[model samples]
Target: MEKFTTLTGVAAPLPIVNVDTDMIIPKQFLKTIKRTGLGTSLFYEQRYHEDGSENPDFVLNQPAYRDAKILVAGDNFGCGSSREHAPWALKDFGITCVISTSFADIFYNNCFKNGILPIIVSAEELEKLLDDASRGANATLTVDLERQEIKGPDGGTIRFDIDPFRKHCLINGLDDIGLTMQKAEAIAGFEGRMGEARPWV
Candidate 1:
């Protein structure tokens, strides 16, 4: 996982609610365990038509949002199955931050593990962010994790809260594997002691 101290980029508005895992990456794209290549398939159904052509109507496919790094979505985002691929797809698509009024617990947790910031704000706050995102190519927002603040295009700021531990993990680029590696010396010492005491076994 990459460290996420601060990010500044365009925010695309996705005002739909109840966006589930399947709607994000679709079941057909789930066979691969690798994280790469999913970006093209993110929101596959909504981004493509029956003939596999790009859907011009989807927010992601629009000219201004094709490279959006943040997403401002409606309430109840990521509300279905606990598929970890949803966050994978989002991160792969260059969206490292997601701002919504609320999110599903599983999806929210998955975002942090994958180096994505999932922000929860009041409904009123979301409306403000959404309004900023509606500005096409000018929907830039800056997310500063250290300050727990989001700076909008018009110089407005919104403060958010996050667990201190999760903030540390993201700041240091520490995933579960990375966290375990931090204890490598201790783990090695314990294994060496166990081996000496149980040589017969």
Candidate 2:
């Protein structure tokens, strides 16, 4: 996991709602547990045709959004299965932040665990962000986690809220394992004490 403090990059507009995990990476791409290579397979079905050619009509296939780091999507984003690979694919694809009106609970948590910031804003605010993203190559938005604000292209700012613990973890690049490791010394001490107390076992 990487620390997510502030990110300023092109925002890709994905107005379609109910984007599920399968649509993100597809089941065929889930054979490998490794995260790095999944980026190319992100949104595989919609991004490619049956003959393996790129779909020019897809938003991600467009040249301007090919390297987008932020996604401004419609409501109910990440609404299906609770696969961790979904966030892995998004992060691998260089999407550091996702802004939407609403997101599925499991997918939202998975995003944070994988170092991706999933932001929820009002419908009105999302429309504005989508408008900014419509500018194609010029759709650049700045996401400042510490300030909990998103700065749009024209300098307008939208505020968002996040849980304090999740915010701290992202700032410090701490995942679940990282959180547990924070008490390494105590864990070691406990093991040592247990061994001394129960030598026969």
Candidate 3:
């Protein structure tokens, strides 16, 4: 996973509620376990029509938001099955941070593991973010993980809370495997001792 320290980029506004994992990547795109190519299929149903044409009405298809690195969405974002691919697709699509009024617990946790920052803010704050995101190409937002702050284009700042441990992991680019690798020496030593102590077994 890539490290997520500070990210400043255009924020795309997605004001829909209950955006589940299926709506994110769709069931059709789940065949591959690899994460790299999933970005093209992100929001497959909403972003593309049945004929496989790009939906002009979709926020991601709009020219201004095509490269958006941040997403300001409505309440209850990421609320469905716990597929880790959701975050993988979002990350691959260049979304480094997701700001919403609320998020499903499992999806929220999945974001950190995949190097995406899922932010929870008050309803009032979300409205402010939505307003900022409505600025089209100018909807740039700066997220400072170290400071736990989101600075909007107009100079307004919003503070968000995050678990310290998760914060540490993201800053250090440590995924689950990366975290375990931190104790490689200890693990190796334990394995060596066990082999010597119970060689017959």
lDDT of each: 0.95, 0.94, 0.94
Top candidate (lDDT): 1
List, residue by residue over 28-65, the lDDT tens digit for candidate 1: 98899999989999999999999999999999999999
lDDT of 3 by residue, 1-201 (tens): 788899999999999999999999888788889989999999998898999999999999999999999999989999999998999999999998999989999999999988999999999999999999999999999999999999999999999999999999999999999999999999999999999999986
Clashing pairs in 1: none
Q: Residue pairs in steric clash, candidate 2?
A: none
Report lDDT (Cα) of residue 43, candidate 1: 94
Residue 195, candidate 2: C-alpha displacement in angstroms: 0.9
Worst 10 residues of 1 by lDDT: 192-201
TM-score of 1: 0.98
Tell me each candidate's RMSD, in Å, in order.
Answer: 0.8, 0.8, 0.8
**TM-scores, in order shown?**
0.98, 0.98, 0.98
What does the lDDT come to for candidate 1?
0.95
Report the number of clashing residue pairs per model.
0, 0, 0
